[model samples]
Target: MPSYTYPVAAPNRTLTTEEIHILLTNTRVLARRLADLTQMRFVADYLLSGRFDATGGGIFYETGEEIFAADAPEAVAPGSEYPKTVLTAGELASARTVKWGIETDITDEKIAQQGQVVVDRALARLANTVIRHVDATAWGVIASKVTSTEASAAWTTPGAALEAIVRVQEERAALGTGLDLSTVVLAPAQYAKVLAMLVDADALPRNDSNPVLDGTLPLRAFGLEWVTSPHVTGTDPWLIDRAQLGGMADQTLGSPGYVSASGVGIETLSNRHKDDKYEVRARRVTVPVVTEPMAGVRITGTGL
Candidate 1:
């Protein structure tokens, strides 16, 4: 709603060992905050549905008429029988803001002296970049796929999944949406040979020690974040390693393909009763944290 920003900490000039400790304590909290904000952005932008090959845009929880859990009065206006409820829409308009309550310690003098300012700043930057990359990928996929905007879920064969990936690339090209799609979410088996193929094509890094493919390719780096549901079962779960998260953020996916008819329809549907059809909209929301990875740990000599 407000361009999605991370909470800012007030600046203080005082520097003490105890204050420094507090800053370090809050650093972890800020990292979690970054995660929370980025996760929200991911869900809002990337929820997928419909047939895998013929998938569509995702549906999000939006506001509309509300039926009270408890009922009392029926009508507030004269001659009105229908339940009166607040109708609303959009993430900014209806979604709850996620807050991470993080507080700093008062006794850490060194952290306070350093201000812990650098760490917080770095966390913010990282969060923004990760959220942006994820949003771009989600939109790229949606724009290229063939399906309905209201598509709830998707199921597809291996072949269709491959085709969908190709179509995604093409769609991006036509729409001037710049993205290189290399990694695709598919039934584990479907990706096995493809993984090998990627390796053979020199697209994937050569590594046998790490069972998980080095999805982080120079031309097409990949990092997988999975949602485990009862529907997705009996699968080899190893995809992307969380350790690789930092690297994947910078890599690009290789050339992709797309077809005009491949994606779901974007439309304005009229609700006759309401007498208006609202357009489904989209945007990439990012939350960023900027912090230094390593803070110098120096032992200061205080007269013992």
Candidate 2:
């Protein structure tokens, strides 16, 4: 059997004392929230059967209620005119704010427990928001922040985001007796290329790779599974009813078999559907931080 060293090696980026201190200071909350959002996106799409369309920090529009009374002969019920309205996703860069402050000054065993609490709360909120937004008729299907700790350290690289996903999966695995990595699914961008690299490096199997199941691995942990988002347009396009459309619906068509009822308007429904990609960030709590000490690091020699 190949002997494995303690604290198995993993890739990491070095941070200066000033950076580390900042991470533990007011930035800790932001880091935690970013971690949560990263993981939530993974869970929502992979673990669950729903699709997550990225917004790329772009704004989106959603419809809302504007009351309108129905025409009646003699009876009247309480209702407002224009019963339905639209609600657009506000600009992310402008509307959202990230706040962070060290909840505790100590960094002992309590650190892990406290961090877990913070992570769980943010993750719960993220999951709830994504599901609610997707289910809402006004919002239709869109993606935004799952959770955010702060803006400073939101994920900028694929690797950082991937690691955050692994951390979340490992925690759940440890709690359950018979659980496996497959309970969670992972899909990465540039997955096929990454897989080829892994194969060349002799890290992954080259033949018969399979799509990952949920929790079976970290989201983006495997190079074989990748998910692509469709292209979306408009600054913030809300779903409008066909009737609300007027002269815009009466424009002349140039393509054959794609004309309107009067052969005047172009066919809009035949266009390919697309969605925006949201900017996401991911962070890990364990990289580089030695939360525990090892048994020995010194050698003793007899005097001779």
**TM-score to true structure, per model:** 0.23, 0.20
Candidate 1: lDDT of 211? 31
lDDT of 2 by residue, 1-304 (tens): 0111122222254444444334334333443333333322322222122221222322222222122223323443567354343443322221111111112123323334453344334433443343333223111122121111111122224454335444544553464422232221112333334344444555543333322222223213343233321221122111111111110001122333221211110111111113311111221110011100110011111000
**Model 2 lDDT at residue 171:** 53
Kindly provide the TM-score of model 1 when superposed on the true structure, using C-alpha atoms. 0.23
Enumerate clash totals for all models, in the order shown. 50, 38
The true-versus-predicted C-alpha distance at residue 152 of model 1, in Å, is 17
Cα RMSD, model 2: 26.6
For residue 285, give model 2's deviation from the true position in Å: 42
Indicate which candidate wins on lDDT: 1
